[model samples]
Target chain A: MITVTGTFTVKKNKIEEFQTGTLELQNASLNTDKGCIEYKFHQQQDAPENFFVYEIWDEMASLELHGASQHFNKFSKLLEGNLDKELDIRIYNTI
Target chain B: MITVTGTFTVKKNKIEEFQTGTLELQNASLNTDKGCIEYKFHQQQDAPENFFVYEIWDEMASLELHGASQHFNKFSKLLEGNLDKELDIRIYNTI
Candidate 1:
């Protein structure tokens, strides 16, 4: 299995707006992808403006496919002007 | 299943040290807990200093148990002066 994690910084007070768009993108991605094991979004209680996206896929290929899918492209583009800072993304494997 | 996501902000340049401690704590937690399905940490490519911790447990109770465990407490304390900001923790359910 492969896991992809993204830590996003929404503009100081723009969390709600960002989440509205993010949820739509996440739901669409999860619903359409067979390789997705889990896709979840979280916000820290203490730092509400910071967000995290956690995803698990069946394999590296599945993850690559996810990156290449239309839904992700849409999501990526959606971040263009909405982010307070650049998105942080990382991939990992079971240790 | 219950998913716990934590967005942590390590001191601007303390990511490596934070991760070393985090990995040890995560390994200990996973090895000792039967309910832990997965525990993974990720750093974004665009923002390398940003980190996310994703965890899946069998249920909310299990997740609660994890939070009360020694490993977690140890990890929490370890973050005391090492963080640049407060930790972000959130819980989510599969929808």
Candidate 2:
């Protein structure tokens, strides 16, 4: 399996907006994408503006498909110009 | 299951040392910790000095024990003053 972790620094005021869109994207990915084992969004306990998405996929193809999904594109558009930095994402092979 | 994601920004020159210590810590946690379902370290592809550790545990008690283990203490000491910033850790319920 492949695991994906993405860290985002959302503007303080856009937290509610980001969460709403992320929940929709997450639901779509899990419900519609094959091999999407897990996909969840989280807010840092201490830092409200810091967000993370942790995902598990059966393989690289599934992950790539997730990136290109309609939900993902819409989510990306929602995030445009609303971040402190570009998304910091890392993909790793599960041990 | 519970998921954990930690981001660490390591000094450029300490990459090798950090990875070595981290590998030992990871091996110990998985091999010895009772409920450590997954523990894997990943280096960001675009940024060499940035590292992430993704973990899953069976329960909160198990995670707490893992945190207080000998290997964890060793790892903590190894990380003292060696990072660019304090470790950023977030915990979330698995979906």
Candidate 3:
């Protein structure tokens, strides 16, 4: 299984808007994709502008498919003007 | 690979304290255990009281072992007076 963990920092006042947009993209991916095991978003307690995205996939190929999908592309494009910092993405392979 | 994701709610004013204690425990586990792939803590953006623990292990047996280990037991006991709610834990097996 392949897991992708992402840490994102939204623009100071645009946190809610960013979350709404991102959640839609995530849910769309989850509902339509066959390989997605889990996709969850988390907000930081001490840092209101910080967000985390945790995703689990069946395999590396499935993850690659996800990256190529339209929803992911849309998510990437959507972040263009809304993010305060680049997304911090980490991929993990189950040992 | 086995992934255990946990969502924990710290008491109203204990977020910082909880984070400090939990991070120490997690670091200790990571340093000592060979089966641990990743053990991370996340705090939610919108929810300041919400904290998430994301852990990946080599297998279920390792996770079970972790549960029985001294550090985990100590962590469990330490939550007695500090937590506002029970730890929400979810386990995922790589497909």
Candidate maximizing TM-score:
2
List candidate 3 segments past 4 Å from native: B1-69, B72-95
Model 1 DockQ (Cα-based): 0.20
> Which docking class does model 2 fall in?
acceptable
Tell me each candidate's RMSD, in Å, in order: 5.4, 3.6, 12.1
Q: Residues B10-82, candidate 2, lDDT per residue (tens digit)? A: 8989988988988898999999999999898877656667778888899989999998999999999988989
For residues B1-95, write the lDDT of model 1, one tens digit per residue.
Answer: 77787766678678778778778877987899769997877665455556677788998788888889898898889889877667877766432
Q: Which pairs clash inside model 3?
A: A43-B43, A43-B44, A43-B45, A44-B43, A44-B44, A44-B45, A45-B44
Give, for candidate 1 chain B, the lowest lDDT window spanning 10 residues. Answer: B42-51
Model 1, TM vs. native = 0.60
Tens-digit lDDT track of model 2 for A1-95: 87788788889999889878888988999999989998888876567677888888999899888889899999999889999868977876432
How do the residues A1-95 of candidate 1 rate in per-residue lDDT, one tens digit apiece? 77787777777767777677678768877898878987877675466677777788888788788788888898888778778768977776532
TM agreement with the true structure for every prediction: 0.60, 0.72, 0.54
Which residue runs does candidate 1 get wrong by more than 4 Å? Answer: A1-53, A56-95
Q: Rank the candidates by TM-score, best first.
A: 2, 1, 3
Q: Give the DockQ-based CAPRI class for model 1.
A: incorrect
DockQ, each predicted model: 0.20, 0.30, 0.05
The positional error of residue A24 in candidate 3, measured at the CA in angstroms, is 0.6
